[model samples]
Target chain A: MGARRQPGAGKVLRGLAMRRPLKEAGVLLVIALTATAASWALRPDRLPLRADPAFYRLELDAPLIDPGPALALYDEGQDLFVDTRPAPPGSLPTIPGAVPIRAASFDDDLLDLFDFLAPDDPVILFGDGNLVPVSNIAARLKERGYGNVRILRGGIKAWIKAQGPVTGTASGKEGS
Target chain B: MMRWLGLFCRLAVGGVFVFASWDKLLHPAAFAAAVDHYHLVPYPLLHPMAYALPLLELITGTALILGLCRRGAALIAGCLTVVFMIAIGSALIRGLDITCGCFHTDGGHAVGISLLVRDLVLLVMCWPPLWLADAGPRVPFLCKKD
Candidate 1:
């Protein structure tokens, strides 16, 4: 390809030159800072805990106790098990000595059910297979300053598989 | 036709950004919780970002709407839309059930394909600014040329 030379090309190019994108970027930054400062002033207390790992951790990260260890803890009477599922139908069973703490009733009944337990007492939450309820309950307990909160791994299904004692027919599966 | 369409796009995108920022500005804690639900942001950065993001949205949105450094606002909005798409897409692929913190922090709306598509449309709206030169002679707001 051959380059074509035009008269007064430099002048034409100079006339067509646009402002640098960087200047525009700087303008945007200033505006962004102003808006952020205004928002911050409006809700200074709304800032979240910066380094709190507890608030950031997901449900899966909640400690999971297998059936064997949970049963051992149960036999030793060293831990309290809280079932996060709704009450099972007449055909399905629940873990022996496990207290029912429905997720729906969590906000209202949490203190009532948990007020009797010491802050350091080990608490385990269980459902059928889903860990959401179990994990949430554990988080709630931890939020209320309860230490040593955990979720039952694989829920009541694993408990049944391990032949753990139950209050009703133990063969059926249940949802969280 | 092109210029008018571009103006329309600019105003619409900016208005949306402003609307989205209002709730997050009012409820930083809820926004932070929604950000936490995404599990994409680092723990240490989450709080600061939660505090900062709404302001960014508010500024950029206003810039777009007012035609103040329209290209710059479009750049920011485009980048934000991309980041949101990636976060939402990752959550969908990973099967993490979460509420999208788009307009609400308590999250009545679930994150899904529909939300992603809406963001994509917004992202598309950002194109006119990226591809076209700024209209008029004098720069608005911050950058006034010699």
Candidate 2:
């Protein structure tokens, strides 16, 4: 009896840690299992060919100081400024010489950009307030073999705030 | 022993499928959007497939999980998994970057290489268990007196 075996410290620790009140323990178990199942069910089997979000976003090769640099690029004809942001009541005050490409409904505008712009032509992407459409367009264009793709870091507001002025192309139709 | 395994298989696989189907059926538009995100199927057929798929997933999932008509249900589920794998594999090969949208939408996750890996793993898990059971063979065991 004096020499009777004792449980290991690890076992004791596990027992102490695992020992929850029955009711609470039951709920915890169910939740744990559910999470496990959900993760297992949703995990993908393969990788996407184009997995880089940054790559999908088209940006300028030049320094991004706001939309100002982007505006400058628009002026220099360095890159095409595809503004998916629709007009704000007044005409589109997009950087002069920049094309009007609304961020939304890409399938429509991309064709026009393709018709007018050259492949090696640089593209600066911006959304209304988000890069979703622009990123989406960048990804699609890359898929279509477009070589020069870049997203303006902060979109139009960044440009306007960063000493960037909208020049050229006074015709601001609601390019919805 | 076989009977117990069948029951286990039915509940495990079927319940998942049933719930998966129910969620999608509740919001077909969202599910369709999910399918569109996959880019495996084109626009024209996306709606029609979305309309029909959830129902199919539900019925087969229920049948397999409930242990009723399991043989047929398991076969269908297996086939569906195969079709999905092919579709997803083709999309990956074609350089489509979209979520598989297997369970829920609002999918922001990038389509990963894991997609193919996970599907291949699931196929391995599902195929063997499904092959052993004969049509309704377990039904007799259930009703049999001990």
Candidate 3:
């Protein structure tokens, strides 16, 4: 009976040992939650509890305009073409009259576009073969109440292939 | 010697997390955008997580640094590091060209193999503080007496 009791005692000790870490973890979680709630409450720029689902939809299902239609819009001189590539101000070749607005600096950069562009303007965003940056900017523009934003299909490469009017000197590998 | 090493690991991991949480806390909207780029969190829950995650990091980090609930903090740090590693690894596998948003929400290092390795190293650093008994004297209301 004493020998059998020894194993039970060891089990109890092991359980106690495990309980300490579990208790600590619970305490840590409570502290974190309380801190987070306090911080969120005090911060002036607290994020909205719920995100706009439309933003996600815009990001995932990017509205793309093919080069032919984009070029036609360009010829009509109505839609605003934005170069969304991550490049310096004047380095990258772009569609004539296209505004260079990198998504990384979208908040600061979009200010310049606001001088000439309106919320209702049809804006076409293009990147250097990657659609991710352009898509992000499109979602951002939507958030800012831009109603008609579209991404250029196949990016700048497609625009070049369509013989679209370019402003800067096109390096052979400009969009490749 | 092992105790000193544990202290070092504890401080190192804690300091990094505390530092990393700063910019995200400042520009949480940008951080939300960064997380959205990963496309992991559901859209409805995204903003809340973006708000909460940095706060969690700061709390756990400070706790670890202060040697208060070091084991728990270290465990949370390890868990975060693992999540980070997985996110980076998935990004690399998917060939997504995006900034890490680890330190800065705006323009941090791009997701790559190097970032994954860094997270792995941080994950390793979390081990000692988690397993080793704390060395210093415990404080009232701050640290638990082990």
The candidate that wins on TM-score is 3
Ranking by DockQ: 3, 1, 2
Best of the two (1, 2) by lDDT: 1
Of the two candidates 1 and 2, the one with more favorable DockQ, higher being better, is: 1
lDDT of all predictions: 0.75, 0.57, 0.80
lDDT of 3 at A142: 85
Candidate 1 chain A, which ten residues in sequence have the lowest lDDT sum?
Answer: A14-23
Model 3, A1-176: lDDT tens digits are 45553567878976776676667767888887887788778975566689976654554434666677789999899998888888876676778788887777888888987788888988988887576667787888889988698888668777878788776654634634
Residues B16-76, candidate 2: write the lDDT tens digits.
6777776666555456656765555655556556656766677667656555445455656
lDDT of candidate 1 over B1-146, digit per residue (tens): 67777877888898999999988877676687788888888888887788778888988888778777777778789989999999999999999899999997755679899999999999999878544665323235554432
lDDT for each residue of candidate 1 in A18-64, tens digit (9 for 90 to 100): 33444565678776777666666666344534647663464463566
**lDDT per residue (tens digit) for residues A1-176 in model 2:** 68978999999975653332223323333443454344334534211222333422334233222354456676677676666566642365555455655545556766766676777877776654465666666777667677687777556655655556665345543233
Best by lDDT: 3
In candidate 3, the residue pairs with backbone N, CA or C atoms under 3 Å apart (3 or more residues apart, or in different chains) clash, namely none
Provide chain B's TM-score, model 2. 0.76
Q: Root-mean-square deviation of each candidate, in angstroms? A: 15.3, 18.9, 14.2
Top-down TM-score ranking: 3, 1, 2
